[model samples]
Target chain A: MIKELLTKERIIIPLTGKTKEEILREFVDHAKELKLIDDSEQVYNRILELENIGSSALEKGIALPHIRDNIIRNIFVLIGISKSGVDFDSIDGELSTIIFFIGAQRNDKKYLPLLSKISQMCSYGETRESLLNAHNVDEVMGVISNWET
Target chain B: MILKGEKRILIPIFSEKDMLYLIKNIEKIDTEGKEFILLRLIDEQMTKNVCQRLRRDPEEYLSSIIDSAWNNLYYFQEELTKKEIHSKVSLKTGNALNELIDFGKKTKIKVILFSRLLDSGFEGIFKEKLLKNLLISWEETIIII
Candidate 1:
């Protein structure tokens, strides 16, 4: 399921941003350029609202910043990797290097399962390290697609 | 990893003993400069025993028990907030172990703190099951007793 949504156009290697907000805006703008979403500012605001509720920074330098809004027609994904890492307000207090920006419908059934799959894929250190060093989208997808659980 | 600033603690509240244990241990932790979040999960399975023993409707029993649990949680939240710790509580239904894993994955959790019942009874059995599942599901995070 994750592999299907993740295409070459959706992946951003060596994301150019310094902070979490900047990274999110860059992802949204990138998605807009790909014609995946219509509005960038609206989506960015919604993501910030979700962050106000709670930070999406997972352990081991991974951040899944997502939003379920009426504007999102399908479960879309935008992947970003930063070797320098950005302060994403993670509970572990570590900088997040891999960022998964998810936009889904409000009542989408596939949202939670997709999140679960991604979380499991990122649980292993080897997979995360591979994702960090991955040069392209296919390499990133290879790491996630080949992972068990 | 390096959990130096904000700390997210997952607390699974099973019985009064678990609640008391958390309250007692909260003071001992060095929560001086770092922000703290107390993610409390009120297990629905623990209330199932009460429903079976009392012979009440499952829905009604769950609602009543959850209300009581919220009261206790709100009280704890108020007290913890006084100590500069943010408290967020959730009422979980179905398998307690699976629910904990789901909640842990959904949130950015750093540490999990649960109580071990000192006796070889239902509490001990329940804690063991939860601990086992937690160990299998959450390998990166820290677990505290």
Candidate 2:
């Protein structure tokens, strides 16, 4: 599961962006096509759905959006970084430049393990710091693959 | 454009059981593409007054998640029985609206089908205007239940 969930396909860091919603929308659309997700309305609703409930923002300009809707099989992750910052509706009222799209299947056990794994990845101070410093695709990919070595 | 030739269809399931139920009807659904996605929503018991009745028990919560997800995939073989649709499942957490939109955008999903939570809190607040902002401008399909 981690092999498929943490592949290079969904990792994007050092992403350039100017708008809050535009960059995120672009990130989401790209990830969906490869996976063949057909519930745009449901997907859209779930994002706004989470916002109304609470923002998924984390510390030091990071936000993990984990919505437990079985839109795609298994847990999906998309890593996006915006140097310019974004209005992420965060609880801290800070500009969110980095976002990770966390998708999970609640009915089964994948959500928790992946969430723990992702959460474990997030807890790494060095990982977050480099992911923030990554200047290009290779640099970003390096930060994404840091967990191994 | 990467999936320009991929076949797309939205399979929205309520609970974990809903997915197993759909397996019985997979043959009738159109599956003429290389990939078929089973978009299932983990409908939490959330009303206007969520009440926090389901207190956060980290271990138990995680256990339930694992149980459902494993079973869902184990039984989705029928989804592949229909030729052309390469079946796969995605799991999301929390409310349906945000979960669906995030899934749609991240997956570049062309369509969305969802069940409307007709609770009192959703009355005038959630309408088409809100949906416009929530949904990506890409081609989409909406099924309101």
Candidate 3:
């Protein structure tokens, strides 16, 4: 399911953004560049609203910033890897190097399952290390495929 | 005083059973003019113990637990939205009782809905003593379904 939504184009390696806000904006902009969503600002704002409620940054170096809005037509997963980790207020207080920004329509049934899958991937130490070590889109895709299999 | 337009309901979900029960009985609760906040709490000690027993990394285990919790709560959120109910999902990690109390105080919640069967899942996490303490900790209404 994740493989279908996340193409090589959606994965950004060594993301240039250095802060949480910058990384989020970068993901939204990349989504815009790929013509995945119609309004980047709207999606960005909704993500911020959810973050204000609670930080999406999980333990380790993973952050999953997500939103479900009416404007989104489908579920999109944008994976970003920041070599210079960003301070995303993670649960373990570690910098976030692997970020998954998810956006989905309010009624998209696959949204939760995709989130669950990503979380499952992050649960494994080898998978998390593999993702961080991935130097390109193909390598990241390889890590995801290996995990899913 | 919770004004007519300011009333909010807090439903703290401890497990999948709690979510299922709440979705099944959402309409019976008086949710009119009130915003619903679905809260899911991850017990830190429980996570640590599980990780230690399984020989898993605590950080990765916690990330997975948090997301799995979100998955359950969001499914409930979607059901509420289908019923045209406005709602939000919150995930927190800590002592369940303390988190509930702190969240209630921070949000000025007017009511908290808990499943009568919650104790079955967490080895009596919501036992009589804790429930009584929760009742005494706040003046708001607590409905155990």
Interface DockQ of each model: 0.06, 0.02, 0.15
Q: How does residue B41 of candidate 1 score in lDDT?
A: 51
Most accurate candidate by DockQ: 3
Interface RMSD computed for candidate 2 is what? 13.0
- Ranking of candidates on TM-score, top first: 3, 1, 2
Give the TM-score of each candidate: 0.58, 0.46, 0.62
| Candidate 3 chain A worst ten-residue window by lDDT | A49-58
- Model 2 TM-score, 2 decimals: 0.46
**Residue A136 in candidate 3 has what lDDT?**
89
Pick by lDDT: 1 or 3, better one: 3
Give the alpha carbon lDDT tens digit for every residue of A38-106 in model 2: 665576566655543334554456666656667756667777887877776543356776677766665
The lDDT per prediction is: 0.71, 0.55, 0.78
Question: How high a TM-score does candidate 1 get?
Answer: 0.58
lDDT of 3 by residue, A45-149 (tens): 877766655466666788888888887767899999998899976544689898999988877888898877786578678999999999789999998887676
Query: What lDDT tens digits, residue by residue, belong to model 1 across residues B30-74?
Result: 655444444445456666785687788878776555545544554
